[model samples]
Target: MTSTPRSPHLPLPAAALLLAVLLTACGNQPAVPDWQANAHGAAERATAADLAGNDRVARQEWARARAEVARTGRPELLARVELMRCAVRLASLEGGDCPAFAPLRQDATAQEQAYADYLGGRLAPEQAALLPAAQRAAATGAVAASAMAEMADPLSRLVAAGAAVQAGRATPAVLALASDTAAAQGWSRPLRAWLRLRAEQARAAGDAPLAAQLERQIAIVETAGQPAR
Candidate 1:
């Protein structure tokens, strides 16, 4: 939102009728789709609005992004877009099946489907081979927090940790790592979200003091990042 360099590591879902995939001229060949340009920041902008807890702006931006991706004429691109949404949600500590990816599954690439399974927490250890390298260890039930740290990109790291959480094999350390990662990135929305989640976990475990500490952390972030009313 503040335009402080949104990382462009991942590719985006394709847009309808807007095949802006750049091409290096090679005789008569078509231009290659610049996957990085197509993805990462665009749809993430939509979800980032949501992460900021702005419901109306989130809805508007999501619709706009979905409309843009609908023109890509590739189902896998759309499916991947949906995956981005689910990953962001997972990192935010929300729980649910990636319902949106189901419809696009019939047309998705095997790799995309495998990723869907990985994110859905239904992937088998053998299927880990099909996943992105950043996520392979997590899919195979490796130490999620450690694996998360191995990722150079902050978002990639969170996505891997989120997949581990979805897989139901995440340790308490996973959430802690997510919080630290968000804080280090100066992502207040996700920092607050992870802190609140940890606070809830502490409350359920009857650790009132720890819960209060976590709440204080959340308050600090929220106060500093207080959005314009």
Candidate 2:
């Protein structure tokens, strides 16, 4: 019986060199952190839940997003998380003192800056007032005109409408923006409620006809979720 010859093996050092080359060729990419992924995913889910009028679910998701981002120890990401946290709080009408967005101001994109500025104007007039008069005026004007509508999320739109009305700048366009938004988001509990509040604001502003019209629209939206007879 003859033994089969085996291929010659590399010496240990040579084998180690080859292994190192192979590993180096593999690129050794870092894995994405679970916390970062979870936070981003939660933030998206929270937005969807909010649009669907699922406040309970959205609230949970927003909290989870903030918590997950906190675990990542990334200050920039934390600022975004805080922005979302404040946005959600404003939605709940518990904005309390305006959130200081200055920490992220330098790093935020233009759109983010606009959103934060708009919210600051509404929730913390004093903070917004610190801006140059022209800039402060522009923020209120933009929100009042609903010029931010194209850039704003639905929740932001609701807040914008309230701010616009409060500023006595709820123009026809602003009213239309709010009316159309509530009509489109009829499923959203908060927006519908906001619409009702807007109707009252309209009445107080001496737009009786508009208030009546909005009240009727609110009635329709309220019945949308009910089981058909």
Task: State model 2's lDDT.
Answer: 0.53
lDDT of 2 by residue, 1-229 (tens): 2322221221111122111112111135544457755765677677667656677997898788778766756555555555555554444333513355677677655444554655554435455544323334434434444353653345555555544544445566665665566556553555565566668778899999989988887677667669988
After superposing candidate 1, which stretches have Cα over 4 Å from the reference? 1-41, 225-229
C-alpha local distance difference test of each model: 0.66, 0.53
* Model 2 vs truth, CA RMSD: 16.3
User: After TM-score superposition, what is the CA distance of residue 105 in candidate 1 from its true location, in Å?
Assistant: 0.2
Model 1 lDDT at residue 29: 55
Scored against the true structure, residue 197 in model 2 reaches a CA lDDT of 66
Candidate whose lDDT is highest: 1
Each model's backbone clash number: 8, 0
Record all residue pairs in model 1 with backbone atoms less than 3 Å apart, i.e. clashing.
11-39, 12-39, 15-71, 15-72, 16-71, 16-72, 17-71, 23-31
Candidate 2 residue runs with Cα over 4 Å from true position: 1-31, 88-117, 122-146, 149-169, 185-187, 205-209
